[model samples]
Target: MYRKSKSNGKATYDLREVVTNIKWSTDLNFSAGELTFDLIQNAHPIIPYTGDIITFRWDHYKIFYGYVFKYEVKEDNTVSVTCYDKSRYLKNQDSIVWQSGTIADRFNNVCKRAGIKHKVVDKPTHKVSAEVCDGKTYFDMVKSAIVKTRTATKHMYYIYCNYDVVELRRAPYKKLKIIIGSKSAMTGFSYAVDINNTANVVKVIQKDTKKSQAKSATAKQDDPKRTSFKSTSAAGKSTEQWGKLQETVNKKNKANHAQMVKQAKDELRKKNRANKELTIDCIGHIDLVAGNAVTIKINDLGKTLKNCPILKAEHNFGTDYNCHLTMKVGAEWLGNS
Candidate 1:
């Protein structure tokens, strides 16, 4: 069901009977959670205009609150509306010179500057040294802070929309809390694994080329002409299993030997893993969005994954209440097994 609100007057709309073709989807890699629905006009004498407020609910649970950014009139007197949560504003570009703050701190500052209501659920324990944004979107700023935090503290944070408020949270914010089997809602499943992106060896090199400034003691240890450092993370076992695939990253400024090593290890940790994915079909869970956790137990294989991440969730409220979820499992690539 949904309610439409405007300045001139207030009106309530029960979409249970009047609206058809209702669907909502969200992805962890995307910035927006969308709502698409077609409203039957003959059943109701109401037409939602652009910029109108849409308060959508499912079974009395507030699912989304957004503005009507688009609307189309059909020849059959039907209105199709598309709305997005507060993350829509993240698309705007801005120039910000942010420095010396934690990820939570920068998130608060960005939300405040963008007029976005936000809350920090799980604060990262690392502070950002500095970041300069020139003609970058707000989401890009958030990502910069996240990258710095992850590199320094080895923690990954997830961001999502809670109603109209942007929430900066950690992983496993919400659990699927359902079993998957023949006896449960689990209907069918398919799995695949690929090593196209696998990289057992990662190297990070730092270069300092400012000739005007004096070099530090560490820089003096290297070639006197210039300062350079290289760090590598190579999984000897994985390299033998798969071929030797290496990649290099270069930075303009300077980082200590330890920092460079940490960065290389981080890169190896991510690239070394194979991409394993599971596509599942089951009954719809209204609260199950991207970045949530779901547990799966395969009795035949005698395997159970406790913190499987939900990468994409598409909930359909059309003919039957069902959802299709794509889970990106971080389980190490098992070669061709």
Candidate 2:
């Protein structure tokens, strides 16, 4: 009797080359009755054979990608796979191409082997009213969502949901979060929001904006120009305060630029100094200061003191002067003789 040995190498499986190149669709149907793969007349149907596996993904929309569960076929041509989901539909509904199968039967076989118990419902659960907000950059809205959700929910972690923000009337509530650059000519202030529970974040923004506007308004009453300044500032209109703010921003930018330049110069100087090949020629005269002892190279002993310019020739003349100092670097320092 000969038996086929299981091997990951190509020789063991005849159709290994065939299975590797198959095109698979990401879309899956998750209805209350049962979550099932939508089959379209073998266009993207599951190949009915051993060693063929399909992974069950739970939150395809989030960062935490789903896992894969192994499946083995029984005599009935139907197979069972284990998953973390515990739902009436999910309980026994997950199936492969049994030649023909529905969500319920698929759910049962998988659930049985996986030891997942679930209730069988006669009808599908009603769809929840949710929305998907796509592509609309919800800068402040998303940021506010993060803060509020972070404050409110403990288990819900914020992940930057990067997708074409699609706004749907019913489904998951989608807040269109976009990142507008500082140079972007957008009217509103930009913010980085947490995406833990975005709906709550939007609500918080709505709540917070009102408070901000109210506070702004109340403050404007004390300074009438403040309101006018803000309104006009959007259109590039300049008020004294606005000018001051602009000046501050400009000055900060200029200071940053200057500091960067200075740092670069210092770095270059240090690098040059470290190079053994590099030499620094001192062109300027060094003057002697009185009361400060001087060390001259023996060769420089009698060089014309005229060009060298005495910085300090005498010191400890306690009788007439504190210390006579002369230098090209500084003014002459000599008291009454």
Candidate 3:
């Protein structure tokens, strides 16, 4: 079942009977689901439009909550609407200066400016000195803040939209109790190990800004040297086989050298993890979402996959009250619960 309403209004309309089809997907990296649905135009009085709110549910479980941004009236008298989770609001470009604080504070500030409703589930223990978002999109700025605020022990953070609220939470230390297999709820499963996009080495180059140079000059008059750039890399499993495939990132802003190095390592880790991936298709698991940890068992594979993080999920609901999902699962090594 699903509900639709104006962006910030109280009125809502149930859409279960009129719902024709749905395609909803969410990814940890993007922090929002690309949700779309089609509804038959009948005697219903409600009409979906831009900036409308949508909430999807499967039985008693809330599946998705988002805002419709696009709609099309089909020739068959049906309407197709495209929506994105609350994080979609962060895509709007803005400029702002942020004072030093924790990752939670930075994210909350961005949400405040963007008018995005949010909740910080996990707060970063570390603190950042200062950051500036000069005409950058809120998404980019918040992502950078998250990268910079990660702890030295390599604590991982996940930012995503849950229902109507934006969430910034620590990566799960404990795996979910649910299992996926032929005998389980999973209906189909496939895996791929592609080295084409795998990168063994990641090099990050952070350029020095005028402010950094000034600070350097003030801190050391005798040395009188400016840290113009910093670079770091990490080797992956395919490093030996592929002879070290290198990926380089150029950052225009100034950041701590150690932090930049960690960022590069994190990027490399993600790439390595993506190289070996499994796609599990099953009937809709209402509670399953990106950033969730779940176990998988395949009889033919002869081994159980444990503590796998969902990288993406695609949900489909069609006629006959049937709903299904295809989830992309992979390994994440931030540490164990």
lDDT of every predicted structure (CA atoms): 0.74, 0.23, 0.70
lDDT by residue (tens digit), candidate 3, 188-303: 77876667776778888865534433344344433335446657766777766667778888743665777777778877876664456677777676556676767878887785
Candidate 3 has its poorest 10 consecutive residues by lDDT at 328-337
Distance from true position, residue 58, model 3, in Å?
Answer: 2.1
Which residue segments of model 3 deviate by more than 4 Å? 1-11, 43-46, 197-240, 244-274, 318-337
lDDT of 1 by residue, 64-128 (tens): 88777888888888989898888877777899998888878877877887798899999777878
TM-score of 3: 0.73
lDDT of 1 at 116: 83
Model 1 earns a TM-score of 0.82
Candidate 2 — which residues are off by over 4 angstroms? 1-14, 20-151, 154-337
Which pairs clash in the backbone of model 1?
A: none
Q: Put down candidate 2 lDDT per residue, 1-337, tens digits, no spaces.
A: 0012223341221322222211111111121111122121223323323322223221232211111234344454333332112222122322233323222333334445445443333211222122232432222222223233323331111111112111111111121122112233112221122212111100000011122234343333333433221110111222232232111011113234445444333332222211111011111111222112222111222221112222222222112212222322111111110
The RMSD of every model to the true structure, in order and in angstroms, is 6.1, 32.7, 7.2
**Model 1 spans with C-alpha error above 4 angstroms:** 5-14, 43-45, 204-235, 255-263, 298-303, 331-337
Best by TM-score: 1
